[model samples]
Target: MNLRPLRPTDLARLVELNDAAYPAVPITPPEEMTALLGQADFTFGVVDETDSLLGFLIGLRPGADYASENYRYFDSRGADFLYVDRIVIDATVRGAGLGRMLYDAVFALARDEARAEIDCEVNLDPPNPQSLAFHDRLGFRRVGEQETKNGTVTVALLAALL
Candidate 1:
């Protein structure tokens, strides 16, 4: 698989992957995604030999002038972190280590930036056991939990020290 920076052309497939992997997460329209592509601290895709996208990730640095409840929670704590907003892989390619590759790239970026940690959140109310286990295997520990969407959904906020 080839891992590379995300391109404008990749957004549609990315939306499909995101919806499939994380239906609970808010859907981003193409126009919004286009803006985010330029604003995000890091965004990348994993593709096959034919250049078909298999997965993608989006991340933001601390203090970014954006509004995601999870991100704002991290910022409010005054932590220097690289916050992974989302990472989604196509169901067909699950367990192919594409997720790990994306995470390793994020880790490298965090280390390079001298950030204190890598932060992300996993679904809890509408539980995703596989994702929880995966993050545990990656050495992320749950630091906190909170409800969003007017207590409709809860997420376990996780972090791995760099």
Candidate 2:
């Protein structure tokens, strides 16, 4: 397997993987993903030896004063944090461990970037109970809850010191 920053050529595949995993997710248009890929702080994909993308993760480097903002249940009382914006794997590969691989890759990126913490949110839709458990297994603890545009309540915000 190979991991790399998202490239323009990977946008459609990336979006497709994301959509397949979370069909109800409100993704930015392909054009927007293309633009966002070039930004300095966002790190994006994971592909296998044949160059097929299995999943992708997007993270942001939160600034110093970013702590004071309300992140629901996430503990952001520290100086630095990497917020996981999204992570999705192709549904066909659901049992293949791609999700964990993608997350491990993102965590490496955060540590390399010297982020003091890592935080992410999981929507509480009925079909996504596994997400809450996954984060828990990875050592993230619930800090609080919030709502999203889809009207689904989030179970809680989760974070772990990197």
Candidate 3:
């Protein structure tokens, strides 16, 4: 497998992978994905030897022109950080180390950019135990929590120092 920058042409497959992940992440429209790509500090795809996208990650830096409540969780804290807006791996490769490879790249960027931490959130309302466990192993702690989408969803604010 190899990691590379995500491009517009990859959106259909990327969105499919993202949607398959479900409320683990909200389903995003292509137009919104385009907008996020514009504001992203980093966006990358993990692909196999055949160049099939296996997963992707989108991260945003502080001060980005983004309106995501998850991003704001860190902003409200006055933290200097890189926020992982979303990450999705194809079900076909879920247990592999691809997620780690994607995160390692983002962590390196956070360090290189002198970010204080890497921030993100995991579902709490519907409960994504595997996701929360993954974040725990990565040293992310619950810094805070919030209910969004009219309280239909609750997220655990998480961060790991760079």
Candidate 4:
């Protein structure tokens, strides 16, 4: 597998993958995705030998103006952090270590930026056990939980020291 910066052409496929993997997360229309890609501190894709997108990650630095409540919450804490806004891998490549690759990249970015932690949230209401376990394995601990989308969804906030 190969990893590279996400491209404009990859948006449609990335959206499809996101919808498949994380239906609970808000769906981003293409124009909004374009804006998000521009705002992201790190946006990258994992690809096959032929460069078909297998997975993607989008993360933001502290103080990004984009308005996910979880992200804003982290920003409000007045701590420097790299927040993982979203990550999605195609089901076909679920066990292929692509998620780890994306996370390792994020970790490296956190270290390079001298950030204190890497922050992300996992669904608690919908209960994604696999993701919870994966984050646990990566040394992330649940720091808190919040009801978002006006209480329609609840997520466990997680953080890993850099």
**Best-fitting candidate, scored by TM-score:** 3
CA RMSD of each candidate after superposition: 1.3, 3.6, 0.9, 1.1
Report, for every candidate in turn, its global Cα lDDT versus the true structure.
0.87, 0.67, 0.89, 0.88
Summarize candidate 3's per-residue lDDT along 21-119 as a digit string, tens digits.
998998888887788888887988999999999999999877877888779778878899889999999988888988888999999888888989999
**Which candidate leads in lDDT?**
3
- In candidate 1, what are the lDDT values of residues 56-131, reduced to their tens digit? 8899988898777888888888989999988888899889899999999999998888999999999898898888
Backbone clashes under 3 angstroms, per model: 0, 2, 0, 0
Q: How do all the candidates rank in terms of lDDT, highest first?
A: 3, 4, 1, 2
56-157 per-residue lDDT for model 2 (tens digits)? 887666552222123323434554777776787777776677778878877887789887778887766535677777888888887666665455444466
Off by over 4 Å in 2: 64-79, 150-155
Per-residue lDDT of 19-72 in model 4, one digit per residue for the tens?
777654568778888888999988879999999999999999887888899998
Cα-based lDDT at residue 34, candidate 4: 83
Clashing pairs in 2: 73-143, 73-144
Candidate 3: C-alpha lDDT? 0.89
Let me know the TM-score candidate 3 reaches against the reference structure.
0.97
**What C-alpha root-mean-square deviation, in Å, does candidate 4 show against the real structure?**
1.1
TM-score of 1: 0.94
Worst 10 residues of 2 by lDDT: 64-73
Displacement of the residue 161 alpha carbon in candidate 4, Å: 0.4
